[model samples]
Target: MEIQKTPLKDCFILKPDVFRDDRGLFYETYNQKVFEKITGLKIDFVQDNQSVSSKGVLRGLHFQNGEMVQAKLVRVVKGKVLDIVVDIRKDSETFGRSFSIILDDVEHLQLFVPKGFAHGFITLSEQSIFSYKCDNYYDKASECGIIYNDATLALDWHLPKEEFIISAKDLELPSFEEAIS
Candidate 1:
């Protein structure tokens, strides 16, 4: 696996060496030794989660605060999505910065979002199946979110607002400023 650093510190794009044949294809999605060597970070994933969303559906800008914060390794297993990660580390140089990539089944690319970042995505195909590994388990009390359309961040979803659909919880999320404060 190769780790490509993103604009935000500690964030990475991981490309695994895929072996293909007429039968199908195989790739080691997560090897502890290889992952630690490539990213120089040791993470003990305690939980795994999956979600499926239809085109135009957006889920995100979410994170867990305090000690519940988690580092995530995410990838799409079907279709495509515009995956995003925003740095929210208070003392980091790249704090408030964001990075995005198109994750699809074809590329099989995975994104590493460090603990102090908020993550989200917008489906770009008819349906998308996404999965992720987290170093920490879900903690409802610590969960928090920033509005996907927070003006200061001005994230370009690459889709018209009217065309997009969001959950009621996502629609009620606070702005970035409110999240930070």
Candidate 2:
């Protein structure tokens, strides 16, 4: 696997070495030893989560606050998506900045999202399967998010605003400024 650093500290884009044959292709997703050696950080992912959504579906700009913050390894399982991560760590240099990448089955790319960032994604294919490995268990009380269209962040989802299918809960999330405040 090749670890590509993002502008945000501790975040990375992992490109696995794929092996192909007449039948299909194979690649090692995660190996704790290799991961630790490459990233220099050891994370134990306790929970694995998966979701399926149709094109235009948008989820997140979300994170867990305080002690419940989670580090995640996220990827596209079967389709394409516009994955985004925002550095929300107040003490970090890249705080408030956002990064975006196109993750799809074709590239087999994964993003390593450290505990201090908020993450979200929008499905770009007719359907998509998204999966993630989180280092911590989830807590409802610790859940927090910035609205997808926060003016301060001005994220480009790639798709027009009218094409997005945002949840009522997500649509009601706080703005980037309001969230930090």
Candidate 2 worst ten-residue window by lDDT: 27-36
Q: How much does each candidate deviate from the true structure in C-alpha RMSD?
A: 0.8, 0.7
Number of residue pairs clashing in candidate 2, backbone atoms closer than 3 angstroms, sequence gap of 3 or more or interchain: 0
Q: Which regions in candidate 2 have their CA more than 4 angstroms from the true location?
A: none
Candidate 1 has its poorest 10 consecutive residues by lDDT at 156-165
**TM-score of every candidate:** 0.98, 0.98
Backbone collision count in every prediction? 0, 0
Cα deviation of 18 in candidate 2 (Å)? 0.7
Q: Write the per-residue lDDT of candidate 1 for residues 1-181, one digit (tens) a residue.
A: 8789888899989998999999999998888898889778999999999999999999998999999999999999999999998898889999899899999999899999999999999999999999999999899999999999999888988778887989999999999999989
Roughly what TM-score does model 2 have, to 2 decimal places? 0.98
lDDT of each: 0.93, 0.95
